[model samples]
Target: MTGAADLLSRLVEEVNPSSAWRDSFIRIPRHRFIPDRIWVEDGDDLAVLDRVDDPDAWLRSCYADRPVVTQVDDGDTTGRGYRSSSASMPSIVAMMLDATDLAAGQRVLEIGTGTGWNAALLADRVGAGNVTSVEIDPAVAAQAEEALGGFGVHVVLGDGEKGYPPGAPYDRVLATAAVQHVPYPWVEQTRTGGRIVTPWGTSFHNGTLLRLRVGEDGTASGRFGGNAGFMWVRGQRTPHGTLDGRVRPDHEYAETSTDLHPYEPVGDFEATFAIGLRVPGMKDLVVFDGDVPGNPHYTVYLMDPGSGSWASWRIRPGPRDYRVRQHGPRRLFDELAGAYTWWQEAGRPAHSRFGVTVTCRGQRVWLDDPGNPVSPEDPV
Candidate 1:
C-alpha cells in the first residue's frame, strides 16, 4: 500500500481553485512538513486539545483542512492550554494558496515559516528562488530550514513581522499567522499592484482571510475575503486581561433606524471585523464566558486609537441585562449589532460580500458589502 506521502498526493483536489491566483495545486510532500507529535482536538471542539505523536496520525492530520495546535501557553510543556505552535493543515494551506493565486515566476514573501510546508508550496509555483520566508522563533526557523532543505528558498531566521526586506518588490506577500493589522513594512516590500494575503483579526473571534493590493507608496488596501482561523504570530498574540474569574455572556444591541433582525452567524465578531484588521495597530475581541455568571460583564472590544484607544458595549445580564452601556469613541457592540442587523435584513449573509480598505492615516473595514467610498472629511 502507498504510504502517507502517497495519500497526500490524492488530497490536493480539495481546495477551491477558482479564487486561487494559480489554478494548480501545490506538490510539496506532506509528511516532510509535520512534527512527530502534534496537538489534535479530542473531539469536534477546539478547546479540549489532545496530543497525537503517532507518525501516521500526524500525517493524516497534516493532510486535513484544519491547523493543528503545536505549542500551548508560553511555558506549557504538556500541550494542554493555548495553542502556540503548529503545522497548518494541508487543506488550510491549499485555501491560503487559493487566496494567493500564485503563478509561476511571481515572487512571493511568506511570513511565519512554521514547518516550511507553505514555503515549499510557494516555491513550487513561484519557483524556490522567488520565495522568501521568515520565522520569529529561532528554533522554529531551524526546524523549517531542516524541513525545506531541497526547496531552494531563503528561510530567514527573523521576525516575520518585519518581512524579508532583501527580497523587496515581491509580487505577493502571504502570512500563515493571523495578524491584528497589515504591517506597513509588508506593504513597502511588495511592488505596486502586487497582492497581499494574510489571516487578519477584527473585533471578533479569529482571523479572516484578507486581500490587499499594494499602492506605489508602501500602503495596501482591500477587504476580507473569507473566514480563516490562525494563531497570531508570537508577537501579535492577544494578551488576555487579568480576568476576575468572570465573563459576561449577555450583550446588548443598538437602536437601529433600519429594520433590524437577529444575526445568523452568532458570535462571529471575527467575521464582522475581517476587513478592518488591515488598519495598523488595530486589535479587536469579544470576551464571552459561560463559566461564571454573577459578575459584571466583560465584552467584545474594538481598540485602535494608535495609543491603544478602544470602544465596547456592555450589559450585565445578572445586574441590569436590559440596560446597555457603550464605552469608547467607537461602540464595538453597536458596530457588531449594525452588521448583524444588516445581515438579517438582507437575508442571512454570505462571506464574499465583506470587504476592507486600509490607508496610511487610519484604517476602516466593511463586511457583507463594500461600504460607501470616503473622502478625507468623512468621519472614521
Candidate 2:
C-alpha cells in the first residue's frame, strides 16, 4: 500500500468521484482516526493489529475500503466479543455523504462517533465548528476526541438516542450506527425541511439506508436508499435472551404443516425488507440439520421476544410442506405467512420503493407514498 491518501483517492474514484465529498476524503487521513491497538478479523477470529508493532499493516488496514473494528462489545470485552464501533467502509461513507446532500455551512449532528473519522469528514464538508457528534461509550469518545483534537469538532459522551439537545434544530442528523426505529428526539432536534439520514432496519435485517426529510410539524419522511450494514445504536441493541430462556416448558403447543416457506422472502433484498416491515420484532433463526448423519433438512425458528411466542419449522427435503409447531398467544408462522402474502400482493417493493415517516404518532414505514403505510405498524 502506498499510503492512506492514495488508498482514499482510489476509494473515492471507485464509489462516487463526482461527490462533493471528494475534497473531504482527501483532506482527512483515515489512519489518524484509527487507534493504536485495534482488532482485525483473522478468518473467523480476531487478532489485534498494533500500529507500533507493524506500521505498514496497520496503515494498510486503516486506509482500506473495508470497515476497521475499533471497539468491540461496547468496549467492554477486549479482543472480539461483538464489534461495537468501527470506521465504516470508505465507499459506504462516501455514499452516505452523497445521500445527505450536505451544504458548506449546514449544522450536522453525528450519532455513534466511533473513531471520529466520519465526523472529521463531515467537519471537512461543513466547517468543524458546525459539526457535533454523540458517542455512548466514554472510552470510545475519549479516543475519538484524541483523534479529532486538532479539528474543532464537539464530541458529546451520552446516549445517542436522546441526541445532543444543546445543539437542537440541526440542519442535518446522521447516525453512523443502525437504529431499529428513528428516535423522536432526532426528528425534533432537526430543523424543518432538514434531513436525517441513517441505517434503519430491524434485528433480522440492517441493510436499508433511510433518508428522511423533516416536515414543519416535527415529522420526518423520506425514501430508503442504498444498502448498508452498521452496528446497532447502543441503546437499541437487542437482548441476547434465548428461546429456551424466554419460553416455559409447560407452555401450550400446536402443530401443522405448510408448503409455504417464510424464508423464501428473506433470500431476496426487497422481499426481506418487506418482510421485516410487515413482521416487525420477529427474530428469524435458521438452523441447518447438517450436524446429523444423512439429514438434508433445516429448521426455522420464528421468535417474538415481546409476547414470548415461538414457532419451529422442521423443513424436510422433499416437495411436501414443512411441519410447524407453535406455542404462545400469537401464531408466529401465521404472522410470517400473512406478511409474505401482503408483500407479494404489494408487488414485493424494493428498499427504494419503501419510505419511512417518524412523528409523535410513531415511526411508520410506507410504500410508494407516505399516505400509504406499511400493513402492520412498525413494532416497538
Candidate 3:
C-alpha cells in the first residue's frame, strides 16, 4: 500500500515546495481529503473510479501528482462530463502556495475550497483558526467542512467571487479556481500590503498564475507567471460545444487560403496566451483525420459562440498554405492572424512579461508595465 510518506517524497522530488510547507505535506495525508468516488477522463467523457471496487488504483491515484476530478456537471450524474471540481495538481498547488509568501499567525482567505486539502495546508502553515475558506457548492462544502472539522479552520458555504466580508482584512487571499477577472471584493477584503494569488486566463487560453499585491488606494496589480492552467470559476466558464454541434456542412462561409500555419498561433504556449488577450471570446480545437493515431492531417477549428463566428484552418503534412474558412459576423481567423503578427512585432514577449492591473473601473492587461496596456489601438 502506498503511504503518505511516499507521496510526500514524490512531491519533494517533483515540486520541491519550500521548507515552510514541507512539514504540512508530510503530516497531512492527501487521500483522506479525496472522495471515495473520483472521476477520471475516458476519452471525451469521465468515468467513475470507486475506492471500494479498486482500492489499490484509488490509493495510487490519490498519491499521483496530477489532479483528480472530484465532481462533474455540478454533481449531476445524468449531465455531460464537465469537470466541475478537482483536487488541483500537487505541483500547481505547491506553486500557488509558494507564490503566497505566507507566514505563521497571518489570516488567510481561501476561495474555491474544493476538497479542503489546500485549506488544510494553509491552516498548517498559519494557525488553523487564522484560515477561512469559502466554497460555493453545497455538497463540496459539506465534505470539506467534515474533513476540516478537527482542524479548526472556518469553512463558509457561499459564492467565492463576493468573498467573505466577515473575514475582511485578511493577510492573504488564495483562489484555487481560475478567473478571467480579479473580483474587486478580494482586493477590498485583503490588507493594503497583502497578496492575492489565483489562476487568470482568457477564452482562448486556460492560463497562468497571477500574484497581485493590494495597494492602499484599493486596487491590486501583478504579473502572470508559471504554466498553471486550472478549471475556470463556474460563473466565468466559456461556453462548451463540440465541433459537430458548432460547424456544419450547410453553413455558408467565405473561403480563403493563408501561408501562415497554426504552428505558433495555436500550438505555441506564449503565442496563444498573448493572442487570447488580444482576441476575446475565441476557442480553438484540433481534430485529426479519421481519428487515427500519428495522422499529420488535421483541422484546427476556431469558434466564437457568442457572435456565431467560426473559422476552420486545414493542415496537411506537406503544404505551407492552409485552406481557411470563416462564417458569421466576426473574422476569427483574421483576428487571430493579426494578434499573432502583433505579438511578433512586439518582440514576442513571454506570457510572464504580461501583467494585470485591477481598479474600480475593472481590469486591464498590460505589457511590460501597467501604463502600456495591451489593446487593439496600441501595437506594443
Top model number, TM-score: 3
Best by lDDT: 3
**Global lDDT of each candidate:** 0.63, 0.83, 0.90
Per-residue accuracy of model 1 over 1-380 as CA lDDT, tens digit each: 34665666466656443444223343566666766656667643345332243555666676666676655564355533677767776656767787787778999999988888778878877776889998877777887899889888888988888888888988999999987656767877889999999987643447578888877765577866666888887776655443221123343334322222112223445334422332334455446466453444545445544333354434344433333344434554455556555555655544455555655554555554336431121112
Each model's TM-score, in the order given?
Answer: 0.71, 0.90, 0.96
Candidate 3 residue spans exceeding 4 A from truth: 376-380
CA deviation > 4 Å runs, candidate 1: 13-26, 43-53, 74-80, 241-265, 268-351, 366-380
* Per-residue lDDT of model 3, residues 95-197, tens digit only: 8999999999999999999999999999988986999999999999999999887887999999999989998899999999999888889999999999999
- Tens digits of per-residue lDDT for model 2, 1-380: 48776876776676664458777877888888899988888875677788999998988888778899887777665433688789999888888888889998999999989999999998988886999999989999999999998787999999998889999879999999999888889999999999999998886677778999999987889999889989898777766676568656887789898888654655567777787777767777766686563456877788888788888888786787889889888898888788778888877777899898888767888889988987645543
Cα distance off (Å), candidate 1, residue 135: 0.6
- Give the lDDT ranking, best first: 3, 2, 1
Which of the two, 1 or 2, has more TM-score? 2
Q: Runs in model 2 with CA error above 4 Å?
A: 43-45, 52-54, 78-80, 242-252, 291-296, 375-380
CA displacement after TM-score superposition, residue 264 of candidate 1 (Å): 3.8
Q: What pairs collide in candidate 3?
A: none
lDDT value, candidate 3, whole model: 0.90
Query: What ranking of all candidate models by TM-score puts the best one first?
Result: 3, 2, 1
The TM-score obtained by model 3 is 0.96
